[model samples]
Target: MKVGVKDLWAGGILIFLALLGLFINGGLLGIGLESHALGTARRMGPGYMPMLVFWLQLGLGCLVVFNAFSNGPDPLERWTKLDLTTLAISVSSGVILWRVMEAIGLNNNYIQVGAPCFVAMAVLAISPAWRPLGLVLASFAIFGLLLEPLGLILALVGLCVVSALADRDHNPVSVIGMTVSLCIICWFVFIYELDIRVPLWPTIF
Candidate 1:
């Protein structure tokens, strides 16, 4: 008994995504550059949130490329080997979160609603296996915890944890090394320069 190659289409998509991510994250999104102060917060326009998002997306894309490449994708096949369970969970969770958004008044309190969505997305990325899923969820929970109520430190710690989990081995030394490096880089762009108002924890409204 053996596995024929997975669909060539998926493999090609994976590779194409990698290249797209690499270029966008490294250059287009300006990951390594500095940004000007946002200037205003009330009357109209240019919010810290958008800059925060740009940085996050840049980071995601870069990390995605790393993930796609490190997996050493299998050869392409005509037939597709779909992971329907994972896809189903992700899509369902996303749609449900969006629907619940209006009920929860997420439009007004974006942070509260967004925190759970972030956690769900991360958790669903893993299969239903508890050991792995629990670990991932725990990290995300800590992130949301820190990102609410107060300061930047806890969120930073959570960020470090989540970033480390992205790797397969979760080797402590390497994870720590990578985490610290990414944190410093992010801090330089988002904190020192852009000065985005990231909550350490969310205050209840």
Candidate 2:
């Protein structure tokens, strides 16, 4: 079977990622994870996630190569240049927001700084018809900002509401129900089951 350029390109990228992951996990050149650091599976060490990711990448790359050989060649889609203006605006806005947050002594979390900029860029760059992305970004930004101050439940609810706005055919009742249910489940799983350290409610509330 004839191989397509698209398949080859994808396969090459996957293979490169797989090798890079492996290199990082294998501690080659004395720069990657050390053997001693990779503890048992039950008590996962620093290298566990990297090893898992690399192995998955390797497997996917192999599958892509096999599919390329098994399938016949097809027409490649035309590649379009990325909108540099959108990228520039998004990056600059994110940087500015981060700096402002730092100056204001708001928690310097990366998500809190980046989310608003992402929403702004999405709203400005994309067609107005697809405003849901902007809504989602805004929701995420709000969630990030409120997560610590308002606590998880309130922040998550706010996230759900704003993100639900992205769907043109959204049902408010369903969105609220789902958001509440998800927040409860997340609170239970992350806080109780996983024993994660996060505030359930604000100190003032």
Model 2 scores a C-alpha lDDT of 0.70
Best of the candidates, lDDT:
2
Candidate 2 contains a number of clashing pairs equal to 1
TM-score of each: 0.48, 0.54
lDDT for each of the candidates? 0.55, 0.70
Candidate 1 least-lDDT 10 residues: 1-10
Flag clash pairs in model 2. 132-166
RMSD of each: 8.7, 6.1
Which number leads on TM-score? 2
Q: Model 2, residue 110: what's the lDDT?
A: 60
Model 1 has an lDDT value of 0.55
Residue range 25-131, candidate 2, lDDT tens digits:
77444455445266655555667657777778878887887788757585566423344454555567767776777777766566656555655645444534335
Write model 1 residue lDDT over 1-205, tens digit each, in one string.
Answer: 2222343334445555544544443433444233434444432134344444554655555555455454545555232223456556666775677677767676666555555556565655575332354456556555655665544655666766775665567788876786667667766776667666665333542
